[model samples]
Target chain A: MTQRWKLTIEYDGRPFVGWQRQDNGLSVQGCLEEAVRRFSGEAATVHAAGRTDAGVHALAMVASLDLEKQCRPDTVRDALNHHLRPHPVSVLSAEPMAEDFHARFSCRGRSYLYRIVNRRAPLALEAGRAWQVSVPLDAEAMQEAAQRLVGRHDFTSFRASLCQAKDPVKTLDRLDVERVGEEIRVTTAARSFLHHQVRNMVGTLKLVGEGKWAADAVTAALEARDRAKAGPTAPADGLYFTGAWY
Target chain B: MTQRWKLTIEYDGRPFVGWQRQDNGLSVQGCLEEAVRRFSGEAATVHAAGRTDAGVHALAMVASLDLEKQCRPDTVRDALNHHLRPHPVSVLSAEPMAEDFHARFSCRGRSYLYRIVNRRAPLALEAGRAWQVSVPLDAEAMQEAAQRLVGRHDFTSFRASLCQAKDPVKTLDRLDVERVGEEIRVTTAARSFLHHQVRNMVGTLKLVGEGKWAADAVTAALEARDRAKAGPTAPADGLYFTGAWY
Candidate 1:
């Protein structure tokens, strides 16, 4: 008999070539699948709630897999963590889930956090973990501009060119910008996102933070429905898949 | 004409051998001196507020150096940071200082922060930045025990075997243990500390947190006045030289 397991994972993402298994380099999915193979002796396919891009971290990414052999939830988590040694990845928790449950399909909402170090000096402790923006940014202005992106609308201005989503429309549940000490954080939530949507929105808001674009400009860009009208996509270093709510 | 300058620095500390200049490997002082030489064309000797051990990080370590060239404070900081490229050490700020100002000798108080991630799974993003303890620790109990070591006392038991201090008696201004989510933070301040004294005290407190040793046991260890009486010294990964006050 086979049992389905739900796994919560955390990864640095600096060394991974994204969440999907790729021929070029390492992937978080590949690591988890290999760990499952080693521990359960079954060549399993691991699926994640979000397919994070290269250099994008995850705090509590939801994933699911099936194992032929019977094992305790703790055993599955511990065994996978042990096998993923020195890879900057950890299986935080594991639980037996219903066969009908799916990590991606069953997920109701997903949240992400993007970190920006607003300082003149370069980063030392957070070298690869955050995007260091040398210019000082006004978080309040960014917050106001971000509000223009919320609600159901066509996100063609924010979506990547290669986005595979069937529709360009997405309902953004929340988009907030706040400052914590020397860092500016952008938090967002939605049922699903177009490729590079979060990063592109953050990039566009940064212009407002720097006093280059106003809140009305963001609304204009959204209405224009052209990717070229919006700001550039922010780097992947600062993006984090925070959680997925069922 | 020589001008004395004060520098506030931040470093990751994983790549270097410590703050002092050494022959074996790279040091924070050596990097600063080299950067000074490259920018000012002067063989400057950089001094630090604390000579941290290997693998110990710093958030705002105060240092001083004398340069013969005339340069603005901002220029000194920017040039040194530019020349110190690729190294984890960074000069956060620079200011002109009086000749009497000394990085180590003139410091009135020093503060350090030790981070411990109390979680079952291993660290992912903060692998080398924090200590990962699998067992759950009682932070309140640890805080209560820490008060026993406060005030002026002979911390002989907590002193390192290689400590160079002339006397073991030192006044501990503060020792606090607090829990934030899954992380335990130990913050301490003192006029001066014996080598490895903070780490030793934290290690002994861990025993009390784990229920292996009682609060009185920590007092007994201090009263023993022997190095072997205290717990083992904690690793250098979790320690950070936070700041120095003049």
Candidate 2:
């Protein structure tokens, strides 16, 4: 009997090419498939809810896979973990799911967090983990400016040129920007996102954080609906796919 | 003419041997001397309050170094930062100090913070940053037990066998243990500490956190004044020389 399992995975995406398998280099899918093959002799493809990009971290990326073996859920988890020890990948949890469940299609909403360390000194422990900006940032201004981007609208200005979305419209459910200590965090949620949409929005908000742009300017950029009007995309290192809702 | 400057330095101690100069490998002193040579063309020796070990970290380690060059304080800071760009060291602040201000001898008290992650899965991003424990721990119990070791004590039970201190007695001002989420942080303060004393105290507290030993057991172990009575020394990865007061 075929059994489907939903796995909540977490990975430091620095080493992988992305979430999807590619011929050029390693991917999260490749690591999952390799671990799965090591545990079960039969090879199976892994499907993920989010196809994150290179240098993008994940806290709870959801995935589903099928196995022919009738092992216990814990057995599969332990075996995969044992085999995956050599890699930086980890499977946080695994459970049996309905055969009809699709990791990518069934996900209702996804959340992403962008971190920025605002300080004069160079980062030590958080060198690659958080985006380090030497100049001080006004997080309050960024938060107010980000609110202008929170409703259903044509996000063509924020969408990447390489984004393959059918339409430019996206309903941004939440965009909360806050500062904690010396770090600024931007949490965003949406049913789905276009490629580089979050990064572009963050880049636009950087102008606000730096005092060059205001909340009204963000509205103007959205009304313009031109990619050239938007700020440059933020780096991928600070972006994390936090979770996905079913 | 001689000029002395006070330096607040931050470093990721993983790459260097320690906070002091040694013949074997790269040291924080060696890096600072190189940066000084690059700027003033004169070899400088830095005197830090704590001579930390390898793989340890520091947030605001205070140091004092004499410079023969008549450069401004900001120039020294910026030039050192410019030259130390290739290395994982940063000069947070540089100010002229009295000639008698020795970093080690003039220090009042030193503080250290140790971090442990209590979880089943191994660390990915925080691999070298925190100690991971598979077994669950009761941090409140550890905190309560930690109070038993506070104040002045011989601490011979917690001292390393190889410790070369003249006397085992020392005044421990504070030893606080607390938990934040899955992390248990232990902060210890003292006028001075014997070799591996903090790590030893934390190791013993782990027994209390695990329900293996009680709060009174810690007091008993300290009173016994026997090295065999205390727990093993914790790993060096999670240790940090947080700050030093002058």
Candidate 3:
């Protein structure tokens, strides 16, 4: 008997190509599939709620797989974690789910967090974990500017050139910017997002934070509806897939 | 003319053998000296406030060096940082100091932070950054037990066998334990510490956290004045040299 299982995972994206399987380099999906095969002796295909880009971390990535082995949820988690050793990945939890459950299709909303170290000194402990902006950032200005990107709209200006989404329209539920000590955090939630949407939006807001652009500039950029009109895309190091909500 | 410069540094200790120069592997001090030589063209010797063990990180470690080259503090910092490229070390600040100033001798107090991830899943993003304890830890118990070694006392039980301290008696200004979500942080401050003192104390306190030992056990361990009476030394991964006071 085969059972569908939901797995919540955490990974350090520094060592992975991306969440999707690719031939160029090691990927999170490839590692998960290999771990599944090593433990359960089953060739399983794991599906994730989001295909995170290279150098993008995940706090709780939702994934699903079907396994024919009869084992406890704890066993599956531990075994997968054991096989995934040496890789910067961990199976946080595994739960048996209904056969109809799907990781990507059943997900209703997704959330992400971007960390910026607002300091002149280069990063030491967080070298690869965060984006360090040398110039002082005004969180208030960025917060006000981020509001322009909220709500439903055609986000072609923020979309990646090679994005495969059929529609450029996306409903952004939340886009908040806040400061924590010397760090600035950008949090966003949405039903779905166009490729590079969050990063492009962050990059644009950063211009506001740095006092180079006004908050209203974001409104104009969104109205332009051209990818070239928007600010440059932020680096992937600062982006984290926080979670997926059903 | 030689100038004395005081420097504040931050480093990820994952790839370092320790803070001091070692023959076997890379060390933070060696790297800093090499960076100094590369930029200043001087064979300068760097002196640090503390000699941390292998895998111990630093948020703001104070060090000092003498150089014959005349340069601004900012130039010293930037040049050293540029020369230290690819290494997980950063010179946060540099200041021209009086001839009497010294990084180690002038230091009055030192503080440290030890992070424990109280979770079942193995760490992914924080693999070598924190200590992961699968079993739930009682922060309150640990805090209570920590008070036993607060005032001036002989810390032979917690001191490393190879400690070079002239005396085992010392005063602990603070030993605090607090929980934040799934993380437990232990903070301590003192004028100085014997080798492995903080880690040994944390190890013993962990036993109290796990309910394997009572708070009174800490009092007994301290009174025993024997290394074997204390818990095992905690791994160096979780320790961070927070700062050194002038």
Interface RMSD of each: 0.7, 2.0, 0.8
Sort by lDDT, best first: 3, 1, 2
lDDT (Cα, 0-100) at B117 in candidate 2? 89
Model 2 has a DockQ score of 0.52
Candidate 2: Cα lDDT at B70? 96
Q: Which stretches of candidate 2 lie over 4 Å from their true place?
A: none
DockQ order of candidates, top first: 1, 3, 2
Clashing pairs in 1: none
Query: Model 3 chain B — which ten-residue stretch has the worst lDDT?
Result: B36-45
What is the C-alpha local distance difference test score of each model? 0.94, 0.88, 0.95
lDDT of 3: 0.95
What tens digits encode model 3's per-residue C-alpha lDDT throughout A140-206?
9999999988999999999999999999999999999999999999999998888989999999999
Best lDDT goes to which candidate? 3
Per candidate, native contacts kept equal: 0.68, 0.34, 0.70
lDDT of 3 at B224: 96
For every prediction, compared with the true complex, DockQ reads: 0.82, 0.52, 0.81
Docking class of 2: medium
What's the true lDDT of residue B37 in model 3? Answer: 93
